[model samples]
Target: MASLSVPINPLPPPVNRRPDVKPEISLTAKERDEEKRRQKVNRKIASQKATSMKLRSEATKAVIGDKSGPSNSKEPLPLLENLRAHIAALRWESALNVFDQLHEQLWYRPDSDIYIKLIVVLGKCKQPEKAHSLFQAMISEGCGVNRESYTALLSAYSRNGLFDKAFSLLEEMKNSLDCKPDVHTYSILIKSCVQVSAFDKVDSLLSVMASQGIKPNTVTYSTLIDAYGKTRKFAKMEATLGEMLREGQCEHDVWTMNSTLRAFGSSGQIETMEKYYDKFQCAGIQPTIETFNILLDSYGKAGSYEKLCAVMEYMQKYYFSWTLVTYNIVLEAFGRAGNLKQMELLFRSMRSDRIKPNCVTLCSLVRAYGKARKAEKILGVLHFIENANVMLDIVFFNCLVDAYGKVGCFVEMKGVLEMMERKGCKPDGITYRTMIKAYKKGGMNSHAKELKGSFASVQKSSPGLERQNLQHSVSRFDSNPAS
Candidate 1:
């Protein structure tokens, strides 16, 4: 009886608490309008950034470098690395096929890490739905779900401009303590907002982060600086830079420096760019090839050809191997400066240097030759293109069409179109638009009108080529700021 008289250990009081969830805020009409204004300006800048970075990435691969090829030291599985390489190359189809092959291998086992990796790859390819499906596969495989997996899916949504879906997922994450959005998650979401030109939402996001006591890290500040700098909000950009410097743990890195330089450099503020470039260098951020490329572009555009040549010489003196982007930039600089002889010489030097020419290289050459009205030179380029075994792209063909059309060589121009078809390169809107202009210039009004009729579909394909039709043929390089 005494043993049964043990003190009753009462159970602790029931633990009960409501989860912390952020209120879903909506933007007012005024805020929306403000974003629209910023959107227009930011999109112009963002599009240029996107185009430049895309070609630059391609250029890096051309030069045996890779900006996005797994920088981590922990080597992944061999098949997984192949998948990553395909992803880095933007070979989405190949990546998917490789992944499929991996799944079928005898050694293959259900792995959440592999699922997340593939999901991230598809996200960058702008295939959010496909990534979403992969997420489902992860769940079905009994691999379980966590914040990282959800964040990867969120990234996919955000990357594809699926803001509503991303936010909804963010809400779901908020409801789940195991998968709440952390600083890295918010940084990605913020960058996504900036990409979509949702500048208005940025302040709200930062406010939420502050409320959450989540101090922004280097990546967060850099993203904001880049977004603001791209929108010409130098005060905001500099303010962000100041904040980053003020943070004891955070400092200016190559990314922040590069973004700031691009904002100033692309906007033709070479002086400001140089000022910041030197400042960043003093801060101990060594320049990369991208740095040299930006220098070349700024100097070239500012008519500081001497400085441009100096940068090239410095690269050579430092034994910096020139990338395809570097060659393209130099070639374009010479072309734009009307140094046709220099352009021609550089092209020959590139060939002799055994640097493989891509569509961009040929496009630059075609443009320079076209500007000089040397149709014969374009013919030589076409011959070189053939020997180089470069796949003919629509841009190359369109440039060819414009080159001949510029010289009133309608026969050759039409023949270029035929060559394009034979090479399985379909003519884009620019192709037809260039032809329409040439036809009008030749006083063939009916022919121009007929081609204009076909433009309905082409315009559907390229909604941004809204420029007015003119006698001057639209070369592919026309929109390339670097060119």
Candidate 2:
């Protein structure tokens, strides 16, 4: 077979060619070395940046007590505890500051529960503006905007007397999907409404709850009972109680019993109170220390010394440790009865039992001494006050002024104003009224007139003083054993 002549052309010689490639590929040796140096520098810069970020994160964790690790199973415990501690202490600014630091953490996640808790704390601390800000931040951070979070913000507004805002939020919740107002939400709002004596609002909230097929829980019924009792709307309170009992699902608890007993007892309905107390006990609700305290306070106020003594004896036999309220009640009872020897004995016993006398205790003593025209005994109380570490409030100072006035110690009576000023408690209407009355009684018409003029000036300077004074006086009276 004849082989065909193959004319295969030789390939071109291998050429040192870079076919329009990237600059680095076409670099000369020096250019290549320079490119390598530039790459190393870029890598070093990146490493330094990563290190700096890590160091900054570590520093932040150290400062804010956020000792988080790679495991993301739980939140940073130290950080949470620090924030909770501040919140519990009512340190609003500190709590928010810690919260901000928590947000900047690498492991931080926007949590609705945490936001809700802070909102609640701010509400209790009367910082509704801060609570709303936190709520907005929660939404921005993609946290779930559910009923609980909304209710928390609503509570913040309502508890602080921002009812208009609270109602608006309620309406918003009603219109929102999956965030409708529930029993707890209505209960919270109702409680706040009751606190501010907005009974009409409370009724409306209750109606809404009923319409929404949300049955009132024990807390709701108890709150209504307590509020009605406080306002002396006995018929309404009784009706509410009846409704609660009619609702088979909502069982009465110790709190309900306490409210009922307090209502009757405080109004001097001893027989009714005793009967209900027995009924509550029969219903398997055990009385607590608060129950007995209420009894003692009621009997003491009614001047039923025998019953008060019986209650005290019963508490002792049952090994119920006496609280400060108990001591104050008993001390005030004995003092009002002019049993100075017994009052003094109880005072000594209170101190022996490591119960430091508070403003209420001292006020009782001063009042008793003043009533007995024993100026020297009042001075002794003053000496004790000076030695002891009791925080005195405006109420206590007012009592001191009245005591000095009763004993015709005009100079000391006048000095109380200065003391109140030093303590940063401005004089309210009751303060001026008390001094004026004292001056009138002491045959100092000029002094009384001067105080009247000052009172006018204060009223002008602070328009809300009268209303606040009335509230303060009512609160003081409610707290007083004599009431």
Segments of candidate 1 deviating more than 4 angstroms: 1-111, 125-144, 442-483
* Reference-based TM-score, model 2: 0.78
Candidate 2's residue-wise lDDT over 1-483, tens digit each? 999887688555468544556554466899889999999999999999999999999888666454453344335677789998997897888988998888767778788888999999999998999899999999998998999999999999999999999999999999998999999999999999999899999989888887889999999999999999888899999899989989999999999998988888888888888988998899799988888888988887789999998988898999999889889989988899999999999999899999989888998999999888888998899789889978887788888888888889999889989988977877777778889999999899999999999899888989897778668866876763422
| lDDT scores in order | 0.82, 0.88
Ten contiguous residues with the weakest lDDT in model 1: 65-74
- Give residue 229's lDDT in candidate 1 (0 to 100): 79
Candidate 2 global lDDT: 0.88
Candidate 1 residue lDDT tens string, 1-483: 455555588655457545668998899999999989998998899999999999998886544323223343222366677887887787877888987876665545688887887788889988999999999988998998999999999999998899999989988998997998899999999999998789877888888889988889989998998889778898989888888988998877888888888878878898889999988989899998888887888788778899999999999999988888888989988987778999988888888888898888888888888888888888888887777789876777777888788887888887887797789766666788899999999998997898788788667766654443222225444433432
| Collision count for each candidate, in order | 0, 0
* Model 2 worst lDDT run, 10 consecutive residues: 66-75
lDDT over C-alpha atoms for residue 99 of model 1: 76
In order of appearance, the predictions have TM-scores of: 0.71, 0.78
lDDT of 1 at 28: 100
Name the regions of candidate 2 deviating beyond 4 angstroms: 1-75, 411-429, 444-474, 480-483
RMSD of each: 29.1, 20.8
